[model samples]
Target chain A: DAGVTQSPTHLIKTRGQQVTLRCSPKSGHDTVSWYQQALGQGPQFIFQYYEEEERQRGNFPDRFSGHQFPNYSSELNVNALLLGDSALYLCASSLRTGDLMGTEAFFGQGTRLTVV
Target chain B: DQQVKQNSPSLSVQEGRISILNCDYTNSMFDYFLWYKKYPAEGPTFLISISSIKDKNEDGRFTVFLNKSAKHLSLHIVPSQPGDSAVYFCAASVAGKSTFGDGTTLTVKP
Candidate 1:
């Protein structure tokens, strides 16, 4: 009955430092997507993964990359972090490989990242 | 530019009244619209959704209305309860890519 889970509830890093955040999707889910929510703004889609392959992605730079594991878990890697990178990193899971129309996505509590 | 826009940053209403939240999107490709309720320090939780094929969908006290012509959509909460007070975010999707609005904070006063 456990939902999506994320590691390091909160993280703080300095500029130029790299960070990797992890996520374990809810049981019976096969797809995982990452989103970045900046202060006072809605979440911006980062990318989505299905079957261990990156199926779809948003407008984020190559510096923002992700990986999906055989177990359906995911990790978002942001390199050369900037102060702008500071935001709430959210991981959502869906049952289907398609978009929101095909399945409902359940999101995790999110990892709050702060760049000093 | 913000493809999806929720103009109201915050709104307040009396308990047991109706709370209407509005959202507008610039992308015509967006066919699926959803409303997510989020609390402070937490990720948004899916509240309800309406597909382009359907103009309106209702469940219990929550309803979502879509107007393709207006490129707009709205979420109506009837008999609003105190628990309904939260930041409501509107999201639109096409394929696997989705866009969300800034959000509107709703406060239902008792």
Candidate 2:
């Protein structure tokens, strides 16, 4: 009954450095999605992974990429991170029912990434 | 351009009162609408949702009303409690991909 879990609860890095954030989706869930939430703003979608492949992506740049392991775990990689990248990175998991009808999405506590 | 918009940044209500949160969306293709609550340092948690086929859905003290023709939806909380004070986000989705609003912070004062 464990919900989605994210690792490295908080991290600080210099601009241009790379950071890798990890996430383990909730048990019984298969789809994983990443979101970024800046101070005082709502979460913004980044990308989604299903069946070990990226099924949908938002407006994020190429510097942001992710992978979904066979075990349903996920990793978000940001290359040459910019100061603007500093935000709370959230991971959400949901069961993908056929036809894409709305399914309940459970979220993790999120990894706070600070790019100085 | 944000497809979903929550114009109110914050709202305050006396305890035991009714709380209404409004959300508007520009995308007509969106078939589902949801509301999520978030506390500081935590991810947004699902609250309630409504689909295009239905105009209203209720769960306990929380209820959502959708007006498809106006492209607007609202969340109503009756007898608001202190625990309900948090930032609420309105989202619209298609094919499971959601577009979120700017979020509204609600404070239920005792």
Candidate 3:
């Protein structure tokens, strides 16, 4: 089965500009989550999308937003990007079982965003 | 605050030796813990995990031990191989969110 996939393996953006990263969840998965991995740091949770609505979020600014399409694909948008926004953006997909999150998640290679 | 912390930034071991990576968490509510390994330019791949209800979980040569009382967990790789050299991440999950550690870079020398 095809695993989770992300677009634009690498990107470069300018400050005060906007950028959108895309993600296609693994087949048979329903939930999509985004994470940011800064240099020499672990992946930090950004937010999660389920049922086409944002279900959970982490300690991120309002400028970070995302959308989940009906096909289970997702897009993460960052407005007014800052140099600190430069990091590896990863997309993870899992299947929701009842009220609990999937026990294991499959991740994509991630998109490396560099803000200049 | 970092809910999950892997204090050791890097570890090195001789081939065929045991490799233990430690992780500590500050959140008591976290019940599920997992370990992931990542190569350069690649996303982390899930390795093994343990639930709060159990203290140990093993798969083949990989094992994970959880100590709920201490809010600590560890991943053990027996007879490590050179190919195992990579960054290992520890994560704790509650609800639908997961918090990850800074990762430990492991180098297995042949």
Question: B10-108 in candidate 3: lDDT tens per residue?
Answer: 999999999999999999989789899999988889999888889999998899999888889999999899999999999999998999999999999
**Between the candidate structures 1 and 2, which one is better when assessed by TM-score?**
2
Which regions of candidate 3 are displaced past 4 Å? none
Candidate 2 vs 3: which has more DockQ: 3
lDDT of each: 0.92, 0.93, 0.95
Summarize candidate 1's per-residue lDDT along B2-105 as a digit string, tens digits: 99999999999999999999999999988788899998877789899888899999989999999999999999999999999999999998886679999999
Residue-level lDDT tens digits of model 3 in A11-114? 99999999999999999999999999999999999999999999999999999999999999999999999999999999999999996653788999999999
Residue B59 local lDDT, model 3: 98
Error of 2 at B29 (Å): 1.0
Q: Give DockQ: model 1.
A: 0.73
lDDT string for model 1 (A40-93, tens) is: 999999999988999888999999999999999999999999999999999999
- By lDDT: ranked, best first: 3, 2, 1
DockQ of 2: 0.79
Worst 10 residues of 3 chain A by lDDT: A97-106
Pairs of residues at least 3 apart in sequence or in different chains that clash in candidate 3 = none
